[model samples]
Target: MRAKAVRMYGTRDLRLEEFELPEIRDDEILAKIYSDSICMSTYKLVEQGKKHKRAPQNMDTHPVIVGHEFAGVIVKVGKKWQDQFQPGMRFAQQPALNYKGSLASPGYSYEWYGGDTTYCIFPHETMELGALMPFDGDSFYKASLGEPMSCCIGGYHAMYHTNKQNYDHEMGTKRGGNILIAGGCGPMGLGSVSYGLVCDYHPRRIVVTDVDDAKIERAKEVVSPEYAAEHGVELIYANTAKMDDPRQGLMDLTQGHGYDDVFVMVPIPSVCQLAGSVLAFDGCLNFFSGPTDKNFSASMNMYDLHYTSTHLMGTTGGNNDDLIEANQLAASGRLDPSVMITHVGGIDSIAETTLNLPKIKGGKKLAYTQFDMPMTAIEDFAKLGKSDPFFAKLDQCCRDHKGLWNPEAERMLFEHKGVKVEV
Candidate 1:
């Protein structure tokens, strides 16, 4: 089958090209991608290319596809997996296939298997390892956000508290304790806050800090104070840039007990350091950011680390279990992953949008893989309304959600744009 995909050939060489796919083996399944949420990690992969550890050494022989956070429909089920998954079934996956400790994954390591493409291949290991997940969600984009949401979930799970006496470490943060999310206005940071509020993470108090006041305001809107109060969570948003002493402000919120769990979202050494300094007794600091620097290091107070039982931990990608949990939470209306998305476009916009993701602020940039549309921010719908009728309806939908993208907006977008939804 011939398909179009954004492929990484070398460092800083991501090209949207047409390519032919090989016949699906009896042990493989073929799927048609519907939606993919562009992640910052994808930007990293695009810049690093062959230099990326998971990427093949020789791009001349092994070009790779460029997305992982995606949802699709099974177009052709393999004979061997006929009883398990059928054609037309909706599917998503945990692309972190840490198979026997191998560094390879679908979006980064495979040539014909990735989310950016119109079609993708699911190998036997993908199904055997149970990474391929079938979801019953209202929006394909919401299902696609599951991968990134699972990554946030995995970070919470990976945090461990140390026993000062025996030095034994226990996984997970303190239940019903205070948690601080540094740079909480970003997409992944918002995901962490949403999961903490909805899931069993049981955060009694959650403090979200960001340097950008506008982002903090939007974050507040996404996870409102009323919603947090209903869940018995004291949610606080702080513009750290305005504070003379950010640490003092955070301490005052926690009554000097400090945060029990600190999630560092920004990939800056200084932000990681700041997050570490605000840890309480037996606190676990989660380094959730992926740094581009190979030798990234942050100064830590070793004395406080040993006496206060504060430790730091990090994880790259989530396992299959996390993906399942994320999908279930989103599908059951427990987790609204749509809050993390700010812009919507089609496959045509992926290349430019991905290349300039850091510059494009607000939240996750979503792509309709089958459609041919320009990148459109929810905020721009009002301006676009005067020119296009479809955008006029989209502007109203955005207004209905207080300038946010909702399932209703996604459905209306397809309807007005004359795009068919494959069930």
Candidate 2:
């Protein structure tokens, strides 16, 4: 089959190209990708390219496709997978295959198996490892956002607090405890907030901190304070950009008790240090962000770690179980991952959009693979509507969902006018 995809040839070299995919083997499955969410980690992969161990070393031999957060439909199932996955079934992936202790993953490691393409083949290893998960959901974006959401869920599970009695550790975030999310205005930050509130984390108070007030407002629009209150969760937003000490406000919010669970959303050392500083007794800090710097280190108060029993940990990506949980939550309407999307576009613009993702403001950039339209921000939908009625409908749909995209909008979009592609 002929398909369009974004390929990374080398460092700072991402190109959109046409390619042919071979027939699926007996142990393989073919998927037609429809929605892919752009991630900041892709930016690091683009800049680092072959220098990164996760990416293919020889670009000429393997011009890798560049995206991981994606969702699609199963177009063709191999002989082995026919009973498990059928044609026209929706699907998403865990992506962090980590096959046999190798550094390779689908988006960064594979030449023909990334999310940027219209169609991709799932190799035997992926099937064996159980990374490709089938989902039943209304919005494809929800499936695409599943991987990142699972990352948040995984981090919460990775966190552990030491028991004063047994001296052992208890895993997972504390229920009915005060939670803090540092740099909680970005896409993942927003996801962490929504998931922490909705799922079983059950935080008594959830505090989100960011430098940009506008971003904090945007975050509120996604997960309103009133909505949090309705869920029996106290959601607090703080701007630490102007404060002399960012941790002071966090401590104040908890009445100088400090946070029971701290999730560091930013990769900077200072932000990690700040997250650690605001830890309450028996607090567990989960460093959620992955940094490019090899020597990135944050100072830790060893005395606090030993006496107060606070500890820190980090995870690169979620396992298969976490992805399944994310999908289940989205399907059940308990979790709305679409709040993470800021801009929507077509496959034609994804190459440039992904290359310059760091410069682009707002949250996740979502792509409708068959659509040919230029990138449009959700905030600019009203303006775009004046020029085109299609965008006007999209504007209403997004507005109906409180300035965020949803399954109804997705169906209405394709039913009204989407770039039709017959695979």
Candidate 3:
């Protein structure tokens, strides 16, 4: 069968091309992708291409598809998996396969398997390793957001603190302790704050710092201080750019005691240094940002590291269990990841939006694989609606939902611009 997808042929070489897919083997499954939200990691993938660890070395020949945070419906279940997954069932992918310590992963390693594609083949390993997960969410976009939300869950789980009794590391963040998400107003940063409110172990306070005022303001609207208070957590959005001494200002919010857990959201060395400076006794500084530079270094306070027992940590893509937890959070209405997505597009918008993801000023750029429309931000819906009726309807849906993307907006998008399959 033929399907359209954005494939990486080489470094910064992404093409939205229609290609043929091989017949699904008895051990494999065929699926139709609906929603895929672009991630920063995917932008890094395009920049490095075959040089990326998860990407195969021969991308010039065997091109790989370029998205992982995706959700879809099972179009045809393979004979071997009939009892497990059936056609028309919703599914979400946990792309960090990490099979047997191999670097192979979907989006970067496979030719006919990725989120950008209208259709894809799930290899046997996706099921064998239980990475292909059932998504019981209201919309396919939420299912796509699950992949990144799971990443946030994994970061939360990966944090470790100094166990005073044994002095051994205790996994997970400190409960009822002050928390900080530096450079956190971005997509994932917003998610980290939202999760902090409803996480099993609640924090006393969550201080989010970002350099951009617009982003900080937008984040507040999504997870406001009032909303956080209802969950018994004090949330503060601080724009460090406005502060003369951001480090001092941030420390003041914690009453000079510092934070128990600090998650660094940006790859900037200064942001990382700032996060390190605000660590309290036995604080766990999570290096959540993935820098492209191999020699990226930051100066941390070594005195506190030695005497305060403050430590650093880092984690990559999430595991299948994290994905499951993320799904549960979304299902139970505990984690609304809508703050992560900013723009919506169609399959035709994949290549450009992905190739220049960093240039696109937004959180997650969601694309519905079956549609044909330009990439448009939710904020611009009203602007575009002034001239176009299709956008006018989509604008109303978003306006009704507090200018955020929701299932109704997705439904109206489909109703206005029905499926357009060239193949």
Candidate 4:
């Protein structure tokens, strides 16, 4: 059997190619992928090429499929797995695989199933134990969002302030506690927003900061007023580039104090510095995004950290339990991650999409192997040059606030077309 997949040949080089299906082992299950979402990590890997040491040995040698977040229907289950999995059942698979005695899967590797393909053969180890969730949901797109949401759940489990008195009470008062999500416009940031809204120790106010106007607009749209009212949380969009002091904006929002919980969704050096600087006394700063280069470093006041009793931690990938909880969250309509999905294309579009990832903005891009849509290569889209109205406005905003717009801020402003001028 031949299946379609986006095969990466080298750094910044990928192609949609056909490959013969491998024979299914006795305990394996074959799934027909319905939807797969692009991951920022994938983009980074393609850019690094051979420098990405974690790429599977054989995968680096041969053309490899390049996606990890996806959902599908179990089409064929091998003999021993047939009873547990049935044909035509909606499901999502956890792509992480850990051959290392450790419990979690490596963040970058092809042994881990890649979702950017037509069909997938899930090994029993992951399918039986990881974040694979059963979904009888409306669409494959919705089911496909499970992996990303599960990653958010994992982040929540790893560091979120729980309602348990031991946790919240020890930190501080829970009622008026504030949570700040920096770089809150990307897919992971949006996931954090959804999870933060539903947390038991829900912050009195959830401050979402992003330089992108479009992302802020979309964030506002997804976090409807009704949801905000019921949850007792207020979503604030801040243009980091415009604010004289980004940390000051957060402090003012929390009434001169900083946030009790701060999640840094982007691993940019400046964002890390901001997170470390603004975290409240006894606050917890969770770094959700993994840093790309080893040279990247952020400056912080060690004395402040020592005196405040604050905690700083980082987590990657999630466990099966997180995926299960994510599935429940979506099924109950408490969190609709599908709102973050904006574009969907077939396997043929993966190469182009990956290449243009840095330029695309607003929402998550999805790739599907089984369905074909009016797909256009992102490269074909005309670049919004400096002469464009939005670009001009963005440049002016950055120029006016010279100190505020860091590299991350500049990228967000460009990607989201968010330029706020005084009326």
Top candidate when judged by TM-score against the true structure: 3
After the best TM-score superposition of candidate 1, give how far the Cα of residue 331 lies from its true spot, in angstroms: 0.6
Using Cα atoms with residue i matched to residue i, what is each candidate's TM-score against the true structure? Answer: 0.97, 0.96, 0.97, 0.81
Off by over 4 Å in 2: 416-423
Comparing 2 with 3 on TM-score, the higher-scoring candidate is 3
List candidate 3 segments past 4 Å from native.
Answer: 420-423
Candidate 3: tens digits of C-alpha lDDT, residues 1-423: 889998999989998899889999999999989889988898888888777888898888989988999999888878889999888889888998878888788888998889998899999998999999888888888899999999888998999887668868778889999999998988999989988999987999999998788898889888899999999999999988888898899899998989999999989988888889888999999999899887899998888888989898898778888899999888777788888888999999988988888888978899999877789899998888899887888888877766789887887777677653221
Query: What digit string (tens of lDDT, one per residue) describes model 2 on residues 171-226?
Result: 78888999999998999989999888887768899999998989998998889899
Candidate of highest lDDT: 3
Q: How displaced is residue 70 in candidate 2, in Å? A: 1.2
Model 4 misplacement above 4 A? 102-113, 128-131, 160-176, 374-423
Q: In candidate 3, what residue range of length 10 has the lowest lDDT sum?
A: 414-423
The whole-model C-alpha lDDT of candidate 3 against the native structure comes to 0.88
Residues 290-309 of candidate 1 have per-residue lDDT tens digits of: 89888989998899887877
For residue 404, model 1's alpha carbon misses the true position, in angstroms, by 2.1
Clashes of 1: 0
Q: Give the TM-score of candidate 1.
A: 0.97
Question: Candidate 1 vs candidate 4: which has greater lDDT?
Answer: 1
lDDT of each: 0.86, 0.86, 0.88, 0.68
